[model samples]
Target: MYERKQEILTKILRAGRRTYFFDVKATKADDYYLTITESKKFTNEDGSFHFKKHKIYLYKEDFNAFKSILEEMTSFIFDKKGEEIISDHNTEQKFINN
Candidate 1:
C-alpha cells in the first residue's frame, strides 16, 4: 500500500548561488492543490542586495491552465535567452589563486 506524504504549512526560502526562491507553501481547502513562489536576488558591488518575488497560486481546477502557461513562459525564456554553455575548467581560477 502506498501512503501520501503529510503536507504541512511550510515556508521554504531557498537561496542559491545567484538567486533566491521564497515559497509560501499551502494546500487547497478541499481539492489537492499547492502554491509556489519564486524570488530572484541581485547583489551590488557595495554589498547591497535586493530581491524580486513572483508567486503563482495554483488550484486543482486550474492545473491545465497553469501548466500551459508555465510551458509557454519557459519556452519563451529559453528561446530568447538561448542556452548557456559552461566550460569544464574554471575560467576564473587564475584570479582566485593569486
Candidate 2:
C-alpha cells in the first residue's frame, strides 16, 4: 500500500516563455508547506522545445520573512521602474496579435 502526497491548492501564472506554479502541499504529519516552481521553455537547435524547472520550498516558519523580503524587492522594482514593460517580447506579441 502506498500513500501519495497531493497538493491541497495550486495556482499557475504564465509570463512570456516562463510559467510559475505555486502549490500548497501537506507533510506526513499533516503540516502544510508551499512550493514555488519556475518553469522556462527553451528551444533546442533541432527546434524542439523543453522546459527547465527550478523549485523553492517554503515552510510555515519562514513564511513571514519570505513574504516580507519578496514584497520589499517587488516594491523596490516598481518604485524604480513604475510598471513599465521593457521587454522586446511585449512589442512582438502586440504585433503578432494584430
Candidate 3:
C-alpha cells in the first residue's frame, strides 16, 4: 500500500463555501510535486454537513505547459469579461423569469 506523503509547504484559499488547498510534497526519492485540492462544503438535510474533496497532482515536468495554458485561459476570460462576477448562477433564474 502507498503511504501518504507529508506536505513540505501549504497554502489555502477560501472562496465562499469552497476552500482550495495547495500543497507541496516530496516523493520517496526526494523529488517534489504539488497537489491542488478543492474542498466544497455540502449541507445535509439533518442539519449536518460534510466536505467533498477533489484533488490534482502536478509534477515538475509538466509545470511550464500547465502554467502557460492556465494563464492563457484565465487571460482570455479576463479580456472578454473584465474581471466582473456578472450574471453568476444566482441571477440565472431571475433572468429567465424576466
Candidate 4:
C-alpha cells in the first residue's frame, strides 16, 4: 500500500485573475515530488465568480529535463519579446515563494 505525506512546502503566485500553487510533498517511500496547480477565476452571468483548477504532478527523476526545457522556452520568449508583458489585459505580476 502506498500513502502520501503532508505537504512539506508551498508557494503561491498571483497573476491577475489567476493563482498558481506550488506544493512540495513526499511519497510513501519519502521521495519528494512537486505539484503545481493553476487556479483561474471566472464570472457567472449573475456576477458570481468560480474557480477552475488544473494540476501537474512532477517527480524528481525528470526535474532536470523539465527545468531545462522550461528555461529554454522562456529564454526563447525573452529573446523574441523581452520581459515586458505584451497584452491589453497585462496585469502586474506578483510572486510569493516561501
lDDT, model 4: 0.93
Q: lDDT by residue for model 4 over 1-98, one digit each (tens)?
A: 76547999999999999999999998878898999999999999999999999999999999999999999999999999999877888776688978
lDDT of 1: 0.56
Model 1, position 96, has a per-residue lDDT of 15
Which of the predicted structures, 3 or 4, would earn the higher TM-score when compared with the native? 4
Rank candidates by lDDT, best first: 4, 2, 3, 1
Query: How well does each candidate superpose onto the true structure, as a TM-score?
Result: 0.43, 0.85, 0.84, 0.90
Q: Scored by CA lDDT, what does every candidate get? A: 0.56, 0.85, 0.84, 0.93
Q: Give the TM-score of candidate 3.
A: 0.84
**Which tens-of-lDDT digit does each residue in 47-83 have in candidate 3?**
9999999999999999999999999999999999898
Task: Give the range where candidate 1 is weakest over 10 consecutive residues by summed lDDT.
Answer: 89-98
| Cα-based lDDT at residue 65, candidate 4 | 99
| Model 1: residues with Cα > 4 Å off, grouped in runs | 1-29, 39-55, 85-98
Q: Report the C-alpha displacement of residue 82, candidate 4, in angstroms.
A: 1.5
Q: How many clashing residue pairs appear in each of the predictions shown?
A: 0, 0, 0, 0
Q: Which ten residues in a row have the lowest lDDT in candidate 4?
A: 84-93
After TM-score superposition, the amount by which residue 52's alpha carbon in candidate 4 deviates from its true location, in angstroms, is 0.7
